[model samples]
Target: MECLTVKQVADIKGCSQQYIRKIIGQGKITAIEAEEPINHRIQYLIPVETLPEDLRQKYYASIATDGPPVPKEKAVKKEKAKAKKPFEAYTKKEREEIMQWCEILEIWQKKRNHFESKVEGDRNVVGYLKCEYPDKQISVDILYRKYAAYKAGDFGGLLDGRGGWNRGKSAVPEVLFLQFLYFYLDDRQPAVSVCYRATVDAAKELYPEMVAQFPSEQSFRRKLKKEVPEAVVRYMRLGEKECFDKAAPYIERWYDDTEANDVWIADNHTWDVMVMRDDGSEVVHRMYLTAFLDAKSGVLTGWNVTDNPCSDSTIFALRHGILRHGIPKVCYFDNGTEFLTYDIAGRGHRTRKSQRDVPKPETILAKLGIEMKNAIVRNAKAKPIERTFSTLKEHISKLMTGYCGGKPSERPESLKRQLKNGSIPVDSEFREIIDTLIEGQYNQEPYGGTEKAYQGMTRLEVWNESIQNTIQRIASEDDLNLMLMRTTRYQKVKRNGVCIEIAGEKLWYSNADTWQHVGDEVYVRYDPTDLKTVRVYDVEDRFLYTCQVEPALLLNFIEDDKAALADANEIVRSRKKAIRNYAKGITDRLPAEYKIDMLDLSIRKAKLAREGVNIAQSSVIEPIRIDPVKETDHLQELPMASGADNVVSIDIERMNARAEMRKRNKRR
Candidate 1:
């Protein structure tokens, strides 16, 4: 291969030297950088032998042609890499939201006339934006940025990270903030400002240098509201009740395969109505309504309207439910004193080591093999009875004549205006009203949460569907008597009969078969509401007799006069005994120095004649006595002190000593 200078190539090819130099510059022909003495400067030359065959042919052919192909268009230069945008760092959801904003902006831009036509009143695009997202308050400026980003790179460009430097990050001392949060989460949950101030103060004490880094109260609040999760905030501010009811993770808890009588929830409700006493007199009294509902069926198994709620009242409600639907597998109760009583929980007293006489409810439920369960305190959602009560009050109770609203603020407008004027039905009338509502309305109405299987079915209907398969535990007559009866322990029998005094009234139980056992001990049981007769059980736990109200003194003869006469005679007997004891005490404490005259016929006659007093004479012998010493005008007088300074202090040391007698009189 032989090398050739650029000038020779140009001469052979019949082209200018500059044209050949241009081809070499374009690298179409082989070229090497070298120094040329002719121009005394650095230059490049081509070798004819090393030239590409195509280019060599083109050079020879161009000599034959008019001119070499015009230099191809200058090679296009590569574009510098596109600059990365700030929005590229945004999260996926953030990008999505931005894209949605971009869509709205695009719509606003494309249909400007249509959007303007839809705008009403004095508002513009903002009103349209509000219409689009009724919940969110989007602004035009926010949409402008979104549109710019969208135009730049579509969805990816819509993402933005501006003004988010402080996001998900806090400057406030975390330990101090948590301490303050815990303080607010307590039962006394304080205000937000209070918690903030507490945190600031604590930060000052614990880490003074970091106090300056703490954000403003408003900024801190925004951070908490935006960055902190709702459940975390609720747990800190509202305590467990709110956490469990509102913020806790939801769990679907259905009975699954449970039947109607599988579980029963019981609770006591204070009714909104004001019922009067049975005496036809209006009174300011509220009635308590204790009720039981089948958990599975939502049926009103039993309910009772009473003046007060106690263990007995709770048992009454339970008994009513049991009689109607049989015994349940479990009785779910609230943390009320009535429901938490020993009777239902079957808790034995620490002082009473023996379970000789357990509460009737506990005993009966145990015998029936039923269990009791209590819901967490203050957690109303755990028990469905709360919802039932709410439904009842809203739908039924509010329509009643004397419906006192649940709260003072919820009182009816009519009731508020005429506070003093309201219809308070008598006890019997109120009872009837309650019975009608429970039986006819509550039970017969469809439950709000009825399953698809039982849709449109009344609670009673659902209950009836499963009632046949239920395990029925019915109480016998004797069992009912024993369970419902209130017991009085340590009662003794008296000669008149097995005398038992109740509320200061003596009651007697006498049977031809057991009258001879008058001096025995007995346990009495009866109904507090109806005290006409009391059942007596002997020491051997055998049924002895039924005691009737016996008035100690027969001052009146009438049926149903048990309490009135018995109470009167008790007062008479109490007064006589008190008088006798008082007289005996005075006689025994009489002064030994004085020769007392118990009776004097001359003095008595003179006093009677002088006073002109009459006495009722009795066919009884009277004893007369004379004074051992005659009355004298002179008598020794003891000095009296007017003040504490002049008073003398008596000392027991100066008293005479008595002997310890060996012989003693035994008195029964």
Candidate 2:
């Protein structure tokens, strides 16, 4: 009698080889072991008669051949041709259905032999399968057909072939569909009906013959929904930013992976409630809240409310947070002009075309050793502070007076009345309300995050617990105030010191060292909150000195109050001393051999002139003669001449006149 190996039996039984081996080991199926070991292992062959009759038929049919049965394992490989679609190409639900069918076939193969006929066995199997899977409807005819196909081509035959050829494709003409897409996929985001009408009009004008064959508007809508992915639709219609925010897969940050102060995120939100301006005018404006949130604990560590978002507000908010929660190692910020300013994140941090000659000054984050990371532009979902703002809008802003809605459409009907009636809170009152809500309500509320370890704990509680073992980097108030000062602006040192404009007033800050830098352009950083002193740095960002406010000059010049006069004199004396010291320093560096005697140089020049070695005359003024010439005795002793012609030589006046004329001509 013919026998089948375990593998062949498993193939015929539509089950795994291990299942057959297990059944044989349990003595459920009769098997004969080979007397000789094959390849260091005993081999078993089960008689064909022992299998279920249906399985026995399949086993014989699989091995039937014209001359000799060919082994399935040793079958010749086909020559390479067009690649077939992989099994993974099927949808998830389709693949699962195929697997279920395979399992049903395997069960049917094992149980068929217990019945008298194949039909009865199939009926019973269907009934059992139906009971086992109440959600699925099992049919005996379909099962028989599937089994026959499976026997012919194994697993591939079970795949659903309906609609496989043209899946995700449409029957509409390509040109017509392209025209429809041109109208539909626009940034303006026209409605489906409008796009359909536009497409029809274009088709009627451009392709008049094909207009009748065009699909209906409803068909176009269905095709669009079926063919285009949601992300692609958003990208084409709404905007790339919206597409990324709504449909893009994002990284999930695990809060437990970091300590409480390890990372912080900051953002600015426009509060929904309007508040009266502090200028005492009858005008109201919406307030902006700049806040820093501890990413791990979801706590609002610090925040500031202002009429608008600016670098000052951002810096003040950061200072508040750092003062209370200690410095964070990493700070996440968005690409806002305020956050990306040179004072916060440093120059050229996330910008283009930075000045090459200018040195990148140290920023607040750099000074405090905090790593500043910028989030993707327009990606609000990445910042936890945005969620905090949302909570504020919902729980806090709605309860306040003059609460305008988030958008114009959502504005309450009574908001205009409230504005006219002057029911809005003042700026200070609004700030107080914000502080109360953030500290007393938001941070103190229980954490609503996916981290199981912090479920029952409040944000503040979690923050405190996480930071129990952490070594926080704390800065003194003086140091923090200096670091958080505004960005350095180019200022030329005046005669007094450097003049900077603060709060619409020009203030002069003078330092003893500034005298040397007079008329030199330097960078100045000053705390707006404290304008008493300003820090100075050279062009290379090297710290020079801290300059104090120059004292006001005394108006009482007649009075004997010499305190102000003394201060002025002291500044002048310091400046003069600085100049003298600088000059002396230069002279001290000179060698004695390089010094020359002025008188000796003049004598050498005169000696060169006497030697007739043509030397250039000095540009210096000639010295006056020290010795006086005595009156000549020739004038006193008359020279007697016998003739009057000889006495003509006594005309000294004409001789002196000629000499004076020659001197005047030489001078001219």
Candidate 3:
């Protein structure tokens, strides 16, 4: 074999030098392998008879298009090199550590969003991890830089570095809520006194190496929408989650709410909780609370919870509450169909028969003669039963306060010797604390009105007053009869000179005494179920006449386009100086100054003054004066301060009933 240089070949083949070079590099045609002086790499030469054949003929074809090919000997060496085993990878423990650090970084990132902590707070995390893994195979610097990138933009190994797949997803994001029970704040959970964000902070002295072991708060939250389970962190939720701590029983004898028989209000309230089962693991459950309340006593009957919707928990709670409390004459409830509608109209007056897929009335409970008092749809004020839930929450909060201390931490501690033995401390332990606090400090705490009111009455006294007054005003026999009657529209007719009509075919006749004048349209009180029946008098001992039925539309109180009553309120009170002045005469002189104030106007008025020095002695006047410091003694003579309707009644009427009561008790 013989070969020419690229320049020599171009000269012999009548092509450019670059063309010969292209043929070699393109690998479209081959040259023969031959030994060279230095064979360290490779040597080749072309065969003189080996010109390309027809398919490979024209120079216009893809002669130099393909990339260069390796020589067979060289290609074999490349294959053997590729076949060599790859380097060994990180061990399982190392992998686990990496996964943990990523998780910790993720959690730290989440904490940033929920807090105003310094950037240093976030930076310190990286600093810790770097210090912990100083001698690791993977550089700590790389992890820090990558995490910094994640902070700005979540691309790259964002998920990989955070505890995305590696972090356990057994609990929801609520597990991320860092709750610590402070024994100083609450003897039990129902009473809490502070609020902290559910996240880690500089306050948490976690080691630098641990960041990678936790999930970013964001990852935990995102996983919550998908329901990733995690351990729950328990805390006293009083001050942070709800009103448990501040609520003191104002009414000494609030109706006990835990009883099953009375008012059952079922609604949803969030818990700042970490639910712990018999196992050591924890979870956060969004509790659906259904507790029974004694309408008369304001006592908590009982309560229950459920993890999800369409649960049996609410119904079960109602059953338990009912059994605990006596079967209420009128059991109050909300409109959730699951509990009341399990059976038709059994326990309540109103049934859950709305067209919107609502459940029917509890026919089973109603059969037992238990009537339901459902709150007005969307109106929380319509039911007193629903209003008493704070009583239970407050009770629980007071209990929690006893067991916690400042810089608070809640661990299972032996309840004070007064409570019970620690090993068997269950509900019994919690209950003992509740009772002790209620008796000692809680009942002694004074509370009167809202931020205003009487200011110092104990919650027990206030609670007692509210219930007693409400019961007297709205739950008396007078209220029942009036509430039972229904409204009916009727027209005047001739029935032996009486108005007659039928509602549900029930019969009633309104003679001249009740019907007075025909052709006067009036609303009447009648039973809708039995129309002919007229309900004359009501529970409040008042006649249900047409005037009361249509008071707003029929009884017009307008005067000069404003309410007559409002206009009357602007008049001077009968006992004021203005009234006395007006009664005697506007021109009469006042003792304070020898000046006459003219009130009523005259078209042509003139002032009479004696210009001459010889005025009559009878015209001379003297000013009357009294010391204001002696006002207390004179007040009984002067009209009650001023404008008082009856000065004698001021002491009995003006003093706040509660204040007066307090004064009387103190005097005793």
Candidate 4:
């Protein structure tokens, strides 16, 4: 009537309870629950009904299913049990058709996944999606009608042109497009390879304007840079359940943190027109503006309007905001492509204040844990950033792009012409115009179904109240360097001790005692975002300094520049424009702190072998292996002996990284 506890079973079986629990773990026994013994060992419980009449004989026979164990009788019985569950008992024809459809869907899903994984590889999907769906509307109508007939059972055959569904060739093709929808979460894509067509061709696939049929991965991404919002549309198309499965958890986790500074959103958008021009030329330039939108504020707390939009456009905008308004905890953005990059993943700003090398206009933000969320391919709801940018473009950016004749130096006469057309020039003039026209617009901004509606106040009003008198603590040079430095310390041995001294002890972290750790070869990792603590693991054959600080830190020690990684991980990881510029120097002068002022130092890199600006390994990064923990010989604490064992053997071999860096420095 009652289930047998693991201890009871173990007692009867004359074995330790752990052995009984292991049997359950290996699926040898079915269990009701598991418990622990007095020694903290686990015990499993089993129901009496689980035993079969011949179980004892089978157990004694020592059946091994993997080898010479399966008897013919049992094998035949197992085969019958292993048969697949039957499909809804469909008529043979219907079942056959479904199988065909399943095959097609699976193929389509596979092809889509292949393309979505890498930007360049998705050219085929893009090519298909970019074409216009000339007959998509007609196809939908025909498909629906055909589906109706098939449902009613009046059709003679279930097969159509595709030999699966009776739906005729419509504008939409036969591909299942879940993969594209999935990868395009929001507008915050770091970089997207764009394949533009000069002209539409007949063979080119076409997409209808209709929202029902989602665009192939191609069209969605092509227009993404231009379309400020609509990045999350595809995922939303998934039934509510799928949407919940993919996004609800992230949302719940976000709400749980509830820390205002935990997540921040920043983006750049073109602003309203305020006409100004080059020093002398009458050639007009429409100032393409950008903003780092603070989702919390829903305001352009940090914004900039420039003549041309480039890769570094967003970074400059961020700098302007931090120097003036203050640093936001998080910056949200859309897949505008330019805004998303591995460089900006966790970084707040790329330009170091002390760097005299002139900060690279574009820099990697991922070194810091600055929560970056890119909008999905066609969904704007995920990126409130695009919506905010749209408004800014309409009311503010349009003014900045106002037709300007020339700079103030020569445009004195043009001001009269500009005034006739209502052009405001300079920051002060634009400020006045915004004060008069845009002041109340935010209050009137309609937020019907969004969360803002319940909050009552417009984003601006709420943000102003929330931020009133609050001062943000800026990371000083010392603060930043401290954050970047490893908690390690390195010192040479002086006393006749077998152990070597190491630096960065602050970096080593573990529940395991480091004081107990004594090894010649060592590797340690520190959190890039929080450098106070480090994870230390023993070195093996490989070491990489640039591995992202998180998951790679699982082990405490690491080897450097081992041949194994080259055979495996030699390709560039997800890269940013700035890193590409200095990739070569990244390994140069690494291991030692080069001048912090040199943050913006640019090296010429050869891509496909021609030379251009790049990030040199010697300048940006260095790899270091953990130095061995010092050994003491007071003759105590050796597990084997009282204290005579004095082996100075440390296994950590140096990563010829220093030699490589010296070579690079010499070249430079």
Query: Model 4: runs farther than 4 Å from truth?
Result: 1-259, 272-274, 323-329, 346-364, 397-458, 464-473, 476-668
In model 1, the clashing pairs are none
lDDT of 1 by residue, 435-537 (tens): 8888898889885663787888888888888766666667765576566565555556664456545547756654333444557877776665567777777
TM-score of each: 0.51, 0.60, 0.22, 0.28
Q: Looking at candidate 3, what is the lDDT of residue 63?
A: 37
Q: Report how far residue 143 has shifted in candidate 1, in Å.
A: 28
- Pairing residues by index, what is the TM-score of model 2? 0.60
What are the root-mean-square deviations of the candidates from the true structure over C-alphas?
Answer: 29.2, 21.9, 33.0, 38.5
Cα RMSD, model 1: 29.2
> Tens digits of per-residue lDDT for model 3 on 1-668?
44534444454455675456446655644666456666553444555445555322332233364422222453444344223221234446645654665666675566555647646555665565556667543333555665775565434333244345645544422323333222223435432122222234321332221222344545544553344222121222234323422342223334433222334444543222223233332331223345555443334444554444232444445444544433344556666664444342332334345633543222434434556566667655555544444443544432342332212264224434323332222333344544465445544556522333435666545445544433221223333333334333333422212222332332434432343343543344543334434544332334544321211122244445356444334332322444455545644434534332232112114222333346457667898987788875656653355656654434533444555456436533
Best by the lDDT measure: 2
Candidate 3 weakest lDDT stretch, 10 residues: 546-555
lDDT of 4 by residue, 364-449 (tens): 34333344655665554576666666565555543442533324553345545675554546544544555444446653454322
CA lDDT for candidate 3: 0.42
Candidate 2, residues 1-668: lDDT per residue as tens digits?
Answer: 88878877776676777668667766778999875365655577898888777877676676574322343676788888544445687678877887898888898788877898988887888888888878765688777778886776544567655566876667677788889999999999999999999999987667654554678888888888887798999999999988988898888877657888998898899989878877778787888999999888889987899886888898889889989999999988888888888767864445556564556566778888999888877667777777778888898999998999889997998999989988889898899988988889889999888889888999999999899858898899988987887756676888878877644667788877777778887878888788888888887888888999975532355757677778777778878988888877776676766544454456668878889866688899788763435545334766666675643347755655576567546533
RMSD of 4: 38.5
> Which candidate's TM-score is highest?
2
